[model samples]
Target: MLKKIGIKDPEKQMLKLMESGAVPYRGVKQKDVRNALEERFEPQVLKSMTDEASLAKRYPGVPHEEAAYREMRRLTDELNSSDKGNLVEDWYERMYAQRRAGSSNRPESRQHQKVSAAEWNKNRPASEQIKKDRFIDRVDSVNIGGKEKPALHEIKSTKGKLQERDKEQFEDMMKVAKAERNGVEARGADGRMQKVDQVVYTLTDPRGVAKNEDWIVDQLTKYRNNLSFEVFDAQGKRMMIDARSLKRSKDGELVLPDGIRNRLGLK
Candidate 1:
């Protein structure tokens, strides 16, 4: 294209264009942009805008909306904690050296906090760091509508197959559980350990009526004469008790319904 326009060295020309902020596209010149920023904000504010350290120190307790400030504060803490070395210093400098352009006043796009140096230190391997970044970045993208996670792959139940050794270890755990006074350990088909306990029922009504023996006895006596009420019989079957035959116990305690008593084998 440049040759057709009577120009040679198109690559060099493109480089010059990019350097001048004109070739790739007509962007605001660096000088003009800086001048415009200065006109819009105070000098101190402009300095803070470019320098992360200055931004944090200037607005240490600013609201979360001021992400740049928060990021700077976090980075500052990381910088202080790490060894006094070129790697950390260079990392911080490289991070803040770039000028940020704001297209809008909304801060939703900036909510993903940058990866901290501490995180980077823990994830020493570049591959691990890349994976972590991808996970976080993908999550941020979904949250901000920059990207949507595929529905099918969203819920991954398993990462890899459970090894035979893990299965043996789980079986050993179950054996150990058998000797315990309560609770039993068992492995599920999904390779997860599950604890089982002897099941017991207790009424959980918050009104406390279920817990009051006297109240229960009174209610049972009042309902005893009602022939329409049903009760469970032996062999796990429902049966109706004749109102005339539903007698109150001499002890003033509610007698268990025949059906329930049969199920529990209680006299």
Candidate 2:
């Protein structure tokens, strides 16, 4: 059916797209998929394929192709509608819901094994830790701090003011960090239990504004200061800064202060 419409080897094209990580899945943006498709096929060709009459005529005898075209049309229609960004978010939410439901249906022993694996993975070295890219609140990267303490970094990019959701997410990360600091000891790569003297919650906002920085600093100083978990730990002291003061490396990675960087051995 695709060949009939001058779309040669649709399966091969799709496979290539998937191999290039252009599919609309977790962490893959809708714009990324659109850009990839636009690069692969002519814009007019895509528009023609999405046209109702064209699809109906081209896919008349192929039920599978017809169903696929129907889905494509539905997605195209949704993209053209008012709720553009919400469609991808809603789809991901549904996927997460289904995953949770499936996990809940697992036998008790299987669930226990999963939990055990998670626990085991938690204490693994930073390089050995499993990546949780699918999670919205997952740690962006991990760094070794002074005395070899593991520090988790949460990176965010915004062109304007920081959102309340961002604060909430960072707070959640701090809570988890605090819990881990007080809980069981973490082992280093050498298999020795390492001490966690402090938990650092570093926010790397490359485009952060002054107002947002002041707001977050005030929130930390006035309310979260007593939380014991350091919002920005520099050496053994707690530190706060205007987001604009944050520096970046030549390669665009966030650059910590000389003291912290030297201690952490971060390049």
Best by lDDT: 2
Worst ten-residue run, lDDT, model 1? 149-158
Give TM-scores for every candidate, taking all chains together and pairing residue i with residue i.
Answer: 0.15, 0.32
Candidate 1 lDDT tens digits, 63-145: 32253423323333232222212222232223322221122221121211233334443524432232222111101111113
Per-residue lDDT of model 2, residues 5-54, tens digit only: 46778878877877777654457787776556545554444445344566
Candidate 1 deviates by what RMSD? 28.6
lDDT of each: 0.30, 0.38
Off by over 4 Å in 1: 1-217, 223-227, 233-235, 242-245, 248-254, 257-260, 263-267
Compared to the true structure, candidate 1 yields what TM-score? 0.15
